[model samples]
Target: MITQRQILGTGAAVLAATLTVAGCSDSGEQSGGDAGGSASIVVSTFPFGVEEFTQAVLDPFTEATGIEVEIDTGSNADRLSQLSLADGSNGVDVMLISDTYAGMGEEEGLFQPVTAADVPTMDEIAPFAVSEQYSGPAYSYQLNGTMYNTDELTAEEAASWDLYANADYAGRLALPDISVTAGQLMVSGVAASVGSGPYDVDAAFATLGEWAPNILQFYSSTTEMTNLLTQGEIVAGDALNGFATELVAAGEPIAWTAPAQGRYMATNRAMIPVGAENVEGATKFIDFLLGVEAQQASAEIVGDLPVNLGIEFPQEIIDVVGDIAQDPTGAGYETLDPREIVPNRDVWVERFAREVVGG
Candidate 1:
């Protein structure tokens, strides 16, 4: 379900999951070294095909810096294990992981600390997107909102987040379980609508309890939520921009919209291993990614929001995400600091189970 606990890079469950990340062989030799002595570095990103990411971010980076690049793809758990094993010389150079894992890795001295001086293009990122806990700023994000089956409800009825609580939606709604990122965003957005921020755990809980009756199911993933919508088993619920775009591409009659209170945002960041053999090259790659060209290209390929400032999205994207820029930290949207949610997440998840799900 990708909880903050998992994202924070902790828990016995995390240990168990990472222990399963066993495929990559440990290499003593430097990766991707060319005849000119320019050394290559290995990078791990979300579970993407080597060809897809190679075209999106890696190829442009290598072309610009003359540094060779090797790519690894896996879940957050696997990436954390790879980072732990790579420290001090085994050779994975950089990784794109959730903010929680990055912070935990920095604390354990597994990753190098980054600053604007190290990647001057950090100036192009929103202040909030720049990590206080890791070397790389946020490279991309998922802006979340209500996704509804267009044939089932008018756009006006789905214009506010309060629809999750309306009894009128009984047997027709779906939502993320409290343990996941989308669930946390739903809780925070509801809390904000009631004038309570995420810190007021009681307020968020109360809001969920009120909405519990109408929630057809508390989903564990976007796939489950979208599948229900596709089959007409559910009408609407919380979903991310990227995945919803996939639903539309697959021919489902679905649409995503930011409600009156605003949408919730979460970002995934990139980090360099603490003792990278090619620190200069790694930093250059990070800077190149933060630049508009890479950022825009990524948005086009992945459908996730870019973190680079001043990158205007296409009219089609702007239509789906009205009032909110593709960037979460951009003007007019409400953003949640994973830091604020991490400390209280376990308690909130427990409470949500007992109170709303009747666990």
Candidate 2:
């Protein structure tokens, strides 16, 4: 597990969120810049994140053009703080943040215009991969879901998150770290299940208060959760697919699902600071990310759905790892859309921290 202390690097402070414009006008047809000679760019990403993303997406850029790149990896909090500080400063070239983390950055203007049109593969990526109005989703995943140990529980019992909270299974379940997006969603599902809407704080905390004891620990890191699963510490509730995929791919018996009761579909995005200095480079990287080869490579390495429309993968890539099966009675788990709930993010987070985290 990557700790925030070891991950956050010293950063240069740029513009805080206090910049105000005399007259707010359109960014005036996305700013454009041509590639001059060769240059390097800095990309900040999540800690213990996918280096394979860089290898799959960045390496080819370097190979094609002699430009070099460097990365600063940290926890979700570290990246958010750094991105907030870099809001108007071009000190950081490009930043990749998860869908859960993207909201704050998107609201704070931490991103620049993406030259999506320049990327030939733009049409091939999934529709949700594109940002709503400002930045676009780099790549995304339905990361929030349940993967139960087959030896301990049968497929019938591992179908949804609610099972862990059932009276029969009480005191034997465990949940993922509260700090991440998927974990929050798994916990949030409990709230939304009994509420009027996705953001109902009243419903979320009530559910957590009830489910809390059944959970052994709110793991702070994926590695810890992995160890817990391996050692039989916690049977299951929810987790990110990477850990689950590895086990399932290895033939460890497991059952998985993304409950329709509002499972999270996490997206990584490319944002340009509102007042960035190297806008040209940032946009270029964004386009590079959306290109065909980049999409193919990124999806292959990271094991998530590719957002870029252009990359056509061989059947091997598409069929390599199949998706999780959804439960028919588990809150319409197949078609949950996360964007609709963005407006309630802060409220949801607070509600989870209070009721679910037992704060």
Candidate 3:
């Protein structure tokens, strides 16, 4: 029953500051420079509009490693801008980036290269967690799928992405706009289901055209979509796993299922900026995050599927989201390679507006 306003911190602007284990200080040293010399690392994360993530993962890492963790959080665009401005001299020690930025970050030399040897917990993770599309490894995962009110749409009708394009569901649906990853995923999911790859841009555009009439509104955030769902405004449509989990837990009548064609899977990778002062400490912390304890906490607290295979999720999570812990590819979930999608992001956005929204 945790509300979005409760999980997502108050919208007050959080200044980026390096907090030491002892207390908060504003010296702004990239690395820990306190007289005590206790190691500290600066980490920048994309605020998923949630506060529980900090308590579930970041705080525990600091307590266990005795490394002061400096936190900076913002929207995806804001975080990337802050990272691009940093040159490692005053850069973040760890950066949690989405697949959209992973390739660009590597091309810009924003992160240090890591391997299984560098991170012992690497082998315990799913093969996809190593991230073929990005230089950094994935720490958490999500799947894009159709979620709907079971009272209205039977599970059979909601069982596939095809439901979005169904003429019967027109004017009662909600969809993600191009700004969010879920919107991009909607493109890929449609393309694959209709027999097209990332290269076939027209195929995706055409599919969305068919779906446009059914979409009542295009949502820019999970909070907006959840509001629509709670108000009985949106009966069925595509959405991310975590958002759906929140709605279900809050006693909403909504339910989710990956389509038969497959869900579009994504991951958030954590990278150490090239100029990180505490490479060893940062690596250990990354390794710790991939361990069972942190992974379990994330799953239980935020419904973020852990990349680690060793950890078991609670039955409640399983009931709401079946087989989410499995390798997305192995489970027949089609993943849009970030490498392929990143280059064409702008074009896709433009087409989404012109073809889907404006059509």
Candidate 4:
């Protein structure tokens, strides 16, 4: 089909055609774009942590059909804006975004609500990603509780997310910036050490206070943390499991602990955008992504677990990618509640901005 520059000015025309073809609720069912008689479909998504998989899974799609595939990837937030701006009324045919981001969009009435019927792999996702309103458990990951230099950690230290700090360990630690669920849980680990424990905000802040004088800089972004770990700029702190894996995989001196404390998990997804007409193609693509083979390929390429249990990866990926890991207490997504940890996301977001990040 058409290239980026060709479609750039056609967003409005595409959206208008979609509106003419179908009707959708703001938070209701969405349609795909005009697959038309064209030889290919253009797909969009936010850039993944690793860029290798951008087109890895698409060739099969092309071979199966004569449809050539075009990929546009960017930050999750930015991708949302682009899709919203393009709509189905615009030329953006399909979108692949994180579930958490989808939840936000779902709230904005951007995506159509969906069920397992829409995408079969919906059943494969861990409960952490599912919600009553939106569709899917597309990609799943756990925010693993890890220690740097696993070689330097003791059996006791390896066992829990409790006070990982010691007088000497102070000032050398790098903690996750408290912005999302992972950051909230990182604070929870410190709470457990200070008697506040997991899901207790009061305790988390107290723990931070204790370490404030000694703790290294509280990271504000994912990239900063990754770079710091890579250059050995900092040794250890509460880190995202994926980043921890990247560091270790790259042979960074850091080692990660699969802590017994409950880890935070995020399941990402994609949904049909409102005010678009590609419903036929968009729905098919969503269904295709949830299939066993596609899920498996996605997990292997991205280093995140497939929500589908049957999708198996090589041993190397399963070992690194975060799946469902129960806490030492054994109460996780199955038995425990998400609200107990985050409660009101708005409140958490606000608190994180002020107290945690000092923003």
Best by lDDT: 3
Q: Give per-residue CA lDDT, model 3, range 52-83, as digits (tens).
A: 77678878887887776766666555666566
Each candidate structure's TM-score, on Cα atoms with residue i matched to residue i, is: 0.82, 0.77, 0.88, 0.74
| lDDT (tens digit, per residue) of candidate 1 on 79-194 | 67656765634455667887756655665678777678988888988776875645668887777678998998877788687788788779789988877677777777777777
- Please give the range of 10 consecutive residues that has the lowest summed lDDT in model 2: 23-32
Q: At residue 144, give the lDDT of candidate 1.
A: 68
lDDT of each: 0.69, 0.57, 0.72, 0.54
Candidate 3, superposed: residue stretches over 4 Å from native: 1-27, 30-38, 48-50
Residue 233 C-alpha lDDT in model 4? 59
Can you write out model 4's per-residue Cα lDDT over 117-198, one digit (the tens) per residue? Answer: 7666666655555666455445555454655665555635644544445656666566676664457566655555455446
Worst 10 residues of 4 by lDDT: 19-28
The TM-score obtained by model 1 is 0.82
lDDT preference between candidates 3 and 4, better one: 3
Alpha carbon lDDT at 173, candidate 1:
94
What lDDT is reached at residue 330 by model 2? Answer: 32
